[model samples]
Target chain A: MKLTCTVNGLRIEATAEPRLLLVDFLRHQLRLTATHVGCEIGVCGACTVIVDDEPVRSCLMLAVQADGCRIETAESLAAGGELSPMQASLHAHHGLQCGFCTPGILMTLEALARSGQLPGDEDGVRHVLGGHVCRCTGYQHIVDAVLAQAR
Target chain B: MKPPSFAYARPGTVAEAAGLLAQGDGAVLLAGGQSLMPMLNLRLAAPDTVIDINGIAGLADVRRDDGRLRIGAMARQAALMRTPAVGEALPLLALALPHIGHPQTRSRGTIGGSLCHADPAAELALVAVAADAVLTLLSSAGTRTVPARAFFLHAMETVRAADEILTEITFPASRPGARCAFRELARRHGDFAIAAVAAEWSPEGLTIAVGGLEATPRVCAHLSRELAGRPFEQAAVVRLIDEELAQTEPLEDGVIGPDYRLQLARVLLNDCLAEVLPP
Candidate 1:
């Protein structure tokens, strides 16, 4: 099947099997490897990405299913050469170590930020960051970084 | 893991979608795909054809008229949370919406999909049965409305024929002064419940449903009738729930044993009743 979608800011046209997952299409076909696929059943947020500005489990969506949608991967954050505000904040707050899940977390928070739902405080940030599991950084720095962006 | 290869079709109208479904060569309707996609990836389901109905027109609106709330099947669960009308007019939905997976999953999970999926532990399924909602099912043949109790046949099964699609659901509005409450006990904030309960209570009567207990959400019809005339004493209600649990064969999900579920169901029933019923 031929899949056409807007990714990051570019229009992409690619051929894929009907069963190809959106995450694989981005990582393998589009060469956008930032969106990791972990716990492929949609429980983990490692596959999270923005589809039409809404955060979704890319592992749970097919490339064919997203034929005409707008998608944003973690690569979009650094598309301009310099770190985006969120990327910089995550670094400053020490929000990552062995960052396999960073891209998905970043995209999830990015969607929240886009929606103006970034929490103003630590607890509020944790509340909104539910369902995302972070095995590293103890989540405190992630909350701190998210708070910085929220402010 | 990737899903097995399949043919896909995006129909622009429900009639076209139904027509395609009526063709039925191992065809499965794809709505939000939050649940179905995972199953596909796991190869638990591999329909030869996936009929994508998200493109279908007139299946994503929510409206209120004639003492009921009509929610189109394709409307996302997150959309329901954002709708002030749902929160203001439907206490049961407002209470249950936040518990259907996390906000992220809710963004793409549709109400119809969840209800049609009919997981025994699904909040929407249990809530609809407790509320006695009605569903509009369509196919190339025509349309039929199935009440919530009749809609769910068993765990992960519904009365919906292989060729039919559930298009809309009408939830009867709660009567004035009615107290509606929902509670679920899960391992985490968004995990499937170990035990869950929903209740609609008023001076007139009681309607209650318990999830994670049986093959389907168990509406305590006998207990609801008993509570209609029974006093609001916590002890009495607890005893009544225990009596009902005695007759039920709770389904064990490996997470908890049936005995634990019965106790948990009793605990949830108490908590839910405390919120809606007088001391």
Candidate 2:
């Protein structure tokens, strides 16, 4: 199947298998590997990405289904070789250790911030972070990083 | 794991989708893909044909129609939270929506997809039963409306025919002064409820529905009627609910026991009823 979508302001036109997940297409076809695939199921948010301004599980969506949609991945965060504010905050706060779950969290927060839905407090940030699973850092630093950007 | 390769059809119309469903040996409708995609990746479902209905028009509408809150089957859970009509007319459903899944899943999970999935612990299906919502199903032959209670046959099973598509669900507008409450207990936030209860109080009567303890949510009809317009007696209502729950065999899985589910049901029902009923 032909998959066409705008990724990080770049028009991507490629042929992919009908069953190819959007996460796979973004990583393999586009070679934009920031989006990590943790659990192939939607349980893990490591495959999160922005589709048409809303954060969605890339693993849960087929590349064909994303045709013509505007997709934003973690690769879009640091375009000018400089850390984006969220990335900077995460780094300053030591939000990530193993970094397997960082890309999805960053993309999730990116969509929330873009939509003006970022929570202002720690509890609210933690609530949104519930969707993500991180074995390292115990989410304390992640909450700090998100709270820093949220305010 | 990845989904098995299969023929994919993005139908432009419900009729076309229904035709694909009717013709294909193993055709499945793809709505939000929040649930279906996971099942497919896990190889739990292997449809020969995947009918992508996301391209169909007018399937995501949420509006008030003829004094009823008519929600299209493809209405995303996150979108429903933003919809004024849903919050204004169906507060119970609005309250339960947050518990369906995380905001990430809710962004793409459709109410119709959840109902069609027919998970016993699904918050939307529990609210559907509690509100007595009417579901409209479409097929190549015609359309039919079934009450939510009758739509769910068992866990992950429904009366919907293979060729039928659930198009919309119509919930009667809440009456003035109607009070409703929803409560669910899950291991974690956004997890499937171990036991959940939805209760509504109105001048006409009372409706209470409990889920996660059985293959389908159990509507406490007689108990609801008995307690209508009466001051809530905690002990008496608890006893009544206990008696009612005793009749239906509770579902027991490896993690949770049947007795624990029944206990959770009792507590949740009491908690929700206390909020809506007169003290």
Candidate 3:
């Protein structure tokens, strides 16, 4: 199947198998390897991406589903050599250790902040990130990062 | 994990989508794909064709008319949560919204898909039952509205025919003085519920719905009758909880035991009742 969609700010097209996952297509076909596949299942938020202004698990979506949609990945958060506020906040708050879950968290948080629907307190930030699992950081710093951004 | 090979069709109209589903053997309708994608990857479901319903028009609108809230099947959970009418008309659904998968998953997960998937532990099922929502199932022939009570047959099972597609869900708007509450206990925030309860109170009586401890959403009509016109006393509440728990038979999954789930159901039900009852 030939699929075409805008990744980040660039329009791209590729012919791929119908079974290819959007996450794998972005990483393998487009060579944009920032999106990580942690739990091929939807349980983990490691495969998060923004599709049509909303966050969705890329691993759970077929590459064909991305047809005619606007997708934003972790790479899009940093443009022209500058980091997005979400990326900078994650770094300042030490939101990542092994960095496996960082990309998913970043993309999700970016969408939340950009949508102007983010919670206004620390506990609210923790509640928002509860979907993503991180063996490291204990989520204290991630919560802190979101809280800092909320302010 | 790679999904088994299958033909994919993006239909421009609901009629075309329904036609494709009817013509293709073992065809599955794809909405958000949050639930179907996992099954496809695990090879638990290998449909011969997938009818992508995303391109179908008029299936994503959430509106209200004639004292009923009508939500399109493709309306995302996040979109439903953000709708002011949902919070105003059905506050229990708004309360349950934060408990569904996180912001990301909820942003793409649709109420129609969740109800169609019919997970025994899903929060939406409990809400639908508590609110007495109506599900509209459509096919090439026509459409029919099935009450939530009759819509779910068993775990991951629904009354929807293979050729039919779920179109919309409708429920009476919440009364101005009605009070509703939802409670669930899971190992983690986003994990499947160990036990969950939804309760709504109006001038007429109380309605209670339980999920995650049975094959389908169970309505405690006896308990509701017991609480009618009677003040919510501790002894009465305890006896009602005991009776409800005694009637349920929870499955023993790896996460928790049936006995533990029964106990948790009682505790959560009590907690939910406390929220709606006045001191």
Q: Which candidate's TM-score is highest?
A: 2
lDDT of 2: 0.91
Model 2 pairs whose backbones collide:
none
**For residues B1-279, could you state the per-residue lDDT of candidate 2 as single tens digits?**
999988899999999999888894689999999889999999999999999999999999998887799999999999999898888999999899988888889999999999999999999999999899999999999999999989999999999999999999999988889998999999988888999999889877899999998999889887797889888898888888877887878998889999999889989988888899888
Grade the docking of candidate 3. high
Error of 2 at B54 (Å): 0.4
**What are the candidates' C-alpha RMSDs?**
1.6, 1.0, 1.4
RMSD of 2: 1.0
TM-score of each: 0.96, 0.98, 0.97
Q: Write the per-residue lDDT of candidate 3 for residues B99-189, one digit (tens) a residue.
A: 8988878887889999999998999999999889999998998989899999999899999999999999998888778889899998888
Scoring model 1 with DockQ, what do you get? 0.75
DockQ score, prediction 2 = 0.89
Give the CA lDDT, 0 to 100, for residue B254 in model 1. 78
TM-score of chain A of each: 0.95, 0.97, 0.96
Give the per-residue lDDT of model 1 (tens digit) for A19-45: 888899999988888899898888888
DockQ category of candidate 1 = medium
Best by lDDT: 2
Candidate 1 per-residue C-alpha lDDT over B1-279 given as tens digits, one digit per residue, 9 for 90 to 100: 678888989899999999999996699989999899989989999899999998887898999988889999999998898898787668898899988887668878999999989888899998888989999999999999999999888889899999999999999888788888899998877888888999988788899889978889989987888887455797778788889888888988776899888888999988887778766
Tell me the lDDT of model 3 at B126.
91
Worst 10 residues of 2 chain A by lDDT: A142-151
Model 1 alpha-carbon miss at residue B164, Å? 0.5
